[model samples]
Target: METRRDLRGILFVLVVFVGLAVIWRDLRYDFNFASDMHKAELGRRRETITQTVTSIALQTQIETQTELTTEIVKLSEDVSPAEKA
Candidate 1:
Protein backbone atom coordinates (compact mmCIF):
# COMPACT_ATOMS: atom_id res chain seq x y z
CA MET A 1 0.00 0.00 0.00
CA GLU A 2 2.84 2.42 -0.80
CA THR A 3 1.88 5.82 -2.25
CA ARG A 4 3.83 7.78 -4.95
CA ARG A 5 5.26 10.03 -2.22
CA ASP A 6 6.78 6.99 -0.41
CA LEU A 7 8.30 5.67 -3.65
CA ARG A 8 9.95 9.03 -4.36
CA GLY A 9 11.39 9.16 -0.84
CA ILE A 10 12.96 5.71 -1.17
CA LEU A 11 14.50 6.64 -4.50
CA PHE A 12 16.11 9.74 -2.98
CA VAL A 13 17.68 7.72 -0.16
CA LEU A 14 19.07 5.19 -2.60
CA VAL A 15 20.62 7.95 -4.72
CA VAL A 16 22.31 9.53 -1.71
CA PHE A 17 23.77 6.20 -0.61
CA VAL A 18 25.17 5.53 -4.07
CA GLY A 19 26.69 9.00 -4.23
CA LEU A 20 28.39 8.54 -0.85
CA ALA A 21 29.88 5.20 -1.91
CA VAL A 22 31.35 6.72 -5.06
CA ILE A 23 32.90 9.58 -3.10
CA TRP A 24 34.42 7.17 -0.57
CA ARG A 25 36.00 5.06 -3.27
CA ASP A 26 37.54 8.10 -4.95
CA LEU A 27 39.06 9.35 -1.67
CA ARG A 28 40.57 5.96 -0.91
CA TYR A 29 42.30 5.89 -4.28
CA ASP A 30 43.59 9.43 -3.83
CA PHE A 31 44.99 8.64 -0.37
CA ASN A 32 46.87 5.61 -1.66
CA PHE A 33 48.39 7.58 -4.51
CA ALA A 34 49.49 10.36 -2.17
CA SER A 35 51.12 7.86 0.17
CA ASP A 36 53.14 6.36 -2.65
CA MET A 37 54.33 9.81 -3.74
CA HIS A 38 55.46 10.61 -0.21
CA LYS A 39 57.57 7.44 -0.05
CA ALA A 40 59.22 8.26 -3.35
CA GLU A 41 60.06 11.75 -2.17
CA LEU A 42 61.72 10.40 0.95
CA GLY A 43 63.88 8.03 -1.05
CA ARG A 44 64.93 10.82 -3.41
CA ARG A 45 65.90 13.06 -0.54
CA ARG A 46 68.06 10.33 0.99
CA GLU A 47 69.88 9.77 -2.28
CA THR A 48 70.55 13.46 -2.69
CA ILE A 49 71.99 13.70 0.80
CA THR A 50 74.26 10.73 0.19
CA GLN A 51 75.57 12.17 -3.06
CA THR A 52 76.34 15.53 -1.46
CA VAL A 53 78.26 13.95 1.39
CA THR A 54 80.32 11.79 -0.97
CA SER A 55 81.17 14.75 -3.20
CA ILE A 56 82.36 16.78 -0.21
CA ALA A 57 84.56 13.92 1.02
CA LEU A 58 86.11 13.42 -2.43
CA GLN A 59 86.91 17.13 -2.76
CA THR A 60 88.62 17.17 0.62
CA GLN A 61 90.72 14.12 -0.31
CA ILE A 62 91.83 15.70 -3.58
CA GLU A 63 92.80 18.91 -1.83
CA THR A 64 94.88 17.00 0.67
CA GLN A 65 96.68 15.12 -2.14
CA THR A 66 97.52 18.33 -3.97
CA GLU A 67 98.91 19.90 -0.80
CA LEU A 68 101.07 16.85 -0.12
CA THR A 69 102.48 16.88 -3.66
CA THR A 70 103.44 20.55 -3.39
CA GLU A 71 105.17 20.00 -0.05
CA ILE A 72 107.22 17.08 -1.47
CA VAL A 73 108.37 19.14 -4.45
CA LYS A 74 109.51 22.01 -2.21
CA LEU A 75 111.50 19.63 -0.01
CA SER A 76 113.20 17.98 -2.99
CA GLU A 77 114.64 21.39 -4.15
CA ASP A 78 116.67 21.63 -0.94
CA VAL A 79 118.49 18.28 -1.48
CA SER A 80 122.12 18.41 -2.70
CA PRO A 81 123.80 15.94 -5.05
CA ALA A 82 126.60 15.39 -2.51
CA GLU A 83 124.06 13.99 -0.07
CA LYS A 84 123.20 11.25 -2.61
CA ALA A 85 126.86 10.06 -3.01
Candidate 2:
Protein backbone atom coordinates (compact mmCIF):
# COMPACT_ATOMS: atom_id res chain seq x y z
CA MET A 1 0.00 0.00 0.00
CA GLU A 2 2.94 2.46 0.56
CA THR A 3 4.96 4.06 -2.23
CA ARG A 4 8.49 5.55 -1.92
CA ARG A 5 7.25 9.12 -1.58
CA ASP A 6 4.79 8.18 1.21
CA LEU A 7 7.45 6.34 3.08
CA ARG A 8 9.79 9.30 2.81
CA GLY A 9 7.11 11.64 4.15
CA ILE A 10 6.50 9.45 7.19
CA LEU A 11 10.21 9.26 7.87
CA PHE A 12 10.50 13.03 7.68
CA VAL A 13 7.65 13.53 10.14
CA LEU A 14 9.15 11.09 12.58
CA VAL A 15 12.51 12.85 12.45
CA VAL A 16 10.86 16.23 13.06
CA PHE A 17 8.92 14.90 16.05
CA VAL A 18 12.01 13.46 17.58
CA GLY A 19 13.89 16.68 17.10
CA LEU A 20 11.13 18.67 18.74
CA ALA A 21 10.98 16.31 21.68
CA VAL A 22 14.73 16.63 22.28
CA ILE A 23 14.48 20.39 22.16
CA TRP A 24 11.66 20.36 24.71
CA ARG A 25 13.63 18.14 27.04
CA ASP A 26 16.66 20.44 26.83
CA LEU A 27 14.54 23.46 27.70
CA ARG A 28 13.12 21.73 30.72
CA TYR A 29 16.58 20.83 31.92
CA ASP A 30 17.70 24.42 31.54
CA PHE A 31 14.71 25.70 33.48
CA ASN A 32 15.39 23.31 36.33
CA PHE A 33 19.05 24.29 36.49
CA ALA A 34 18.18 27.98 36.56
CA SER A 35 15.67 27.46 39.36
CA ASP A 36 18.20 25.58 41.48
CA MET A 37 20.76 28.33 41.04
CA HIS A 38 18.26 30.99 42.11
CA LYS A 39 17.35 29.04 45.23
CA ALA A 40 20.99 28.79 46.26
CA GLU A 41 21.52 32.48 45.65
CA LEU A 42 18.49 33.36 47.74
CA GLY A 43 19.77 31.31 50.64
CA ARG A 44 23.13 33.07 50.49
CA ARG A 45 21.40 36.47 50.46
CA ARG A 46 19.43 35.58 53.58
CA GLU A 47 22.59 34.64 55.39
CA THR A 48 24.21 37.91 54.42
CA ILE A 49 21.19 39.87 55.59
CA THR A 50 21.24 38.11 58.96
CA GLN A 51 24.91 38.88 59.46
CA THR A 52 24.36 42.51 58.56
CA VAL A 53 21.51 42.84 61.05
CA THR A 54 23.60 41.27 63.81
CA SER A 55 26.52 43.61 63.15
CA ILE A 56 24.26 46.65 63.33
CA ALA A 57 22.75 45.47 66.59
CA LEU A 58 26.17 45.00 68.14
CA GLN A 59 27.28 48.47 67.09
CA THR A 60 24.20 50.03 68.58
CA GLN A 61 24.71 48.19 71.86
CA ILE A 62 28.34 49.32 72.08
CA GLU A 63 27.34 52.95 71.48
CA THR A 64 24.62 52.79 74.14
CA GLN A 65 27.05 51.32 76.69
CA THR A 66 29.55 54.11 76.08
CA GLU A 67 26.85 56.72 76.55
CA LEU A 68 25.76 55.16 79.85
CA THR A 69 29.31 55.06 81.18
CA THR A 70 29.79 58.75 80.38
CA GLU A 71 26.59 59.67 82.19
CA ILE A 72 27.60 57.69 85.29
CA VAL A 73 31.01 59.39 85.47
CA LYS A 74 29.42 62.85 85.18
CA LEU A 75 26.90 62.05 87.93
CA SER A 76 29.67 60.83 90.29
CA GLU A 77 31.63 64.04 89.78
CA ASP A 78 28.59 66.19 90.62
CA VAL A 79 27.92 64.29 93.83
CA SER A 80 31.54 64.11 95.09
CA PRO A 81 31.64 67.66 96.52
CA ALA A 82 28.30 67.29 98.28
CA GLU A 83 29.45 64.12 99.93
CA LYS A 84 32.71 65.71 101.08
CA ALA A 85 30.78 68.46 102.89
Candidate 3:
Protein backbone atom coordinates (compact mmCIF):
# COMPACT_ATOMS: atom_id res chain seq x y z
CA MET A 1 0.00 0.00 0.00
CA GLU A 2 2.85 2.46 0.66
CA THR A 3 4.51 1.73 -2.69
CA ARG A 4 1.20 2.19 -4.48
CA ARG A 5 0.69 5.56 -2.77
CA ASP A 6 4.16 6.72 -3.83
CA LEU A 7 3.52 5.73 -7.45
CA ARG A 8 0.23 7.61 -7.51
CA GLY A 9 1.89 10.77 -6.21
CA ILE A 10 4.57 10.63 -8.89
CA LEU A 11 1.99 10.12 -11.60
CA PHE A 12 -0.07 13.03 -10.37
CA VAL A 13 2.92 15.38 -10.42
CA LEU A 14 3.91 14.24 -13.87
CA VAL A 15 0.42 14.86 -15.24
CA VAL A 16 0.35 18.34 -13.78
CA PHE A 17 3.69 19.21 -15.38
CA VAL A 18 2.49 17.90 -18.75
CA GLY A 19 -0.66 19.95 -18.53
CA LEU A 20 1.29 23.11 -17.72
CA ALA A 21 3.67 22.53 -20.61
CA VAL A 22 0.80 22.17 -23.06
CA ILE A 23 -0.88 25.33 -21.82
CA TRP A 24 2.31 27.36 -22.05
CA ARG A 25 3.03 26.12 -25.56
CA ASP A 26 -0.43 27.10 -26.74
CA LEU A 27 -0.19 30.54 -25.17
CA ARG A 28 3.17 31.24 -26.77
CA TYR A 29 1.89 30.25 -30.19
CA ASP A 30 -1.19 32.41 -29.83
CA PHE A 31 0.86 35.43 -28.78
CA ASN A 32 3.20 35.06 -31.75
CA PHE A 33 0.30 34.67 -34.18
CA ALA A 34 -1.46 37.78 -32.88
CA SER A 35 1.72 39.82 -33.07
CA ASP A 36 2.30 38.84 -36.66
CA MET A 37 -1.29 39.65 -37.64
CA HIS A 38 -1.08 43.09 -36.05
CA LYS A 39 2.13 43.83 -37.90
CA ALA A 40 0.50 42.77 -41.16
CA GLU A 41 -2.68 44.79 -40.67
CA LEU A 42 -1.19 47.97 -39.25
CA GLY A 43 -0.77 49.74 -42.58
CA ARG A 44 -4.18 48.74 -43.88
CA ARG A 45 -5.83 49.95 -40.71
CA ARG A 46 -4.09 53.31 -40.90
CA GLU A 47 -5.13 53.83 -44.50
CA THR A 48 -8.71 52.89 -43.76
CA ILE A 49 -8.85 55.32 -40.85
CA THR A 50 -7.37 58.14 -42.88
CA GLN A 51 -9.81 57.63 -45.71
CA THR A 52 -12.78 57.58 -43.34
CA VAL A 53 -11.68 60.80 -41.68
CA THR A 54 -11.17 62.54 -45.01
CA SER A 55 -14.57 61.44 -46.26
CA ILE A 56 -16.23 62.76 -43.11
CA ALA A 57 -14.44 66.09 -43.41
CA LEU A 58 -15.46 66.52 -47.04
CA GLN A 59 -19.07 65.67 -46.26
CA THR A 60 -19.08 68.23 -43.45
CA GLN A 61 -17.68 70.91 -45.72
CA ILE A 62 -20.35 70.25 -48.34
CA GLU A 63 -23.13 70.42 -45.79
CA THR A 64 -21.77 73.67 -44.38
CA GLN A 65 -21.57 75.26 -47.81
CA THR A 66 -25.11 74.20 -48.63
CA GLU A 67 -26.41 75.68 -45.38
CA LEU A 68 -24.59 78.97 -45.99
CA THR A 69 -25.97 79.22 -49.50
CA THR A 70 -29.49 78.67 -48.27
CA GLU A 71 -29.08 81.39 -45.65
CA ILE A 72 -27.75 83.82 -48.24
CA VAL A 73 -30.71 83.16 -50.50
CA LYS A 74 -33.13 83.80 -47.65
CA LEU A 75 -31.38 87.02 -46.81
CA SER A 76 -31.44 88.15 -50.42
CA GLU A 77 -35.18 87.56 -50.64
CA ASP A 78 -35.72 89.71 -47.55
CA VAL A 79 -33.81 92.63 -49.13
CA SER A 80 -35.29 95.01 -51.74
CA PRO A 81 -33.81 95.77 -55.19
CA ALA A 82 -32.97 99.25 -53.95
CA GLU A 83 -30.77 97.71 -51.25
CA LYS A 84 -28.62 96.13 -53.96
CA ALA A 85 -28.25 99.48 -55.73
Best by lDDT: 3
Instruction: Please give the distance, in angstroms, between residue 69's alpha carbon in candidate 2 and its true position after superposition.
Output: 0.8
lDDT of each: 0.59, 0.60, 0.61
lDDT of 3 by residue, 1-85 (tens): 4465456556556655655555565556555764767645654554555565556556655665676688789999999999989
* Model 3, global lDDT: 0.61
Cα-based TM-score, every candidate: 0.55, 0.53, 0.53
For residues 1-85, could you state the per-residue lDDT of candidate 1 as single tens digits?
1354355446556555655555455456555664777656655654565555556556655665676687788878778878857
- The local lDDT score (0 to 100) that residue 39 gets in candidate 1 is 55
- What RMSD does each model have against the real structure? 31.3, 30.7, 27.7
Instruction: Give residue 16's lDDT in candidate 2 (0 to 100).
Output: 53
- Reference-based lDDT, residue 37, model 1: 75
Off by over 4 Å in 2: 1-34, 81-85
Residue 31's lDDT within candidate 1 is: 57
Instruction: Report backbone clashes per prediction.
Output: 0, 0, 0
Candidate 1: residue 1 Cα off by (Å): 99
For TM-score, candidate 1 versus 3, the one ahead is: 1
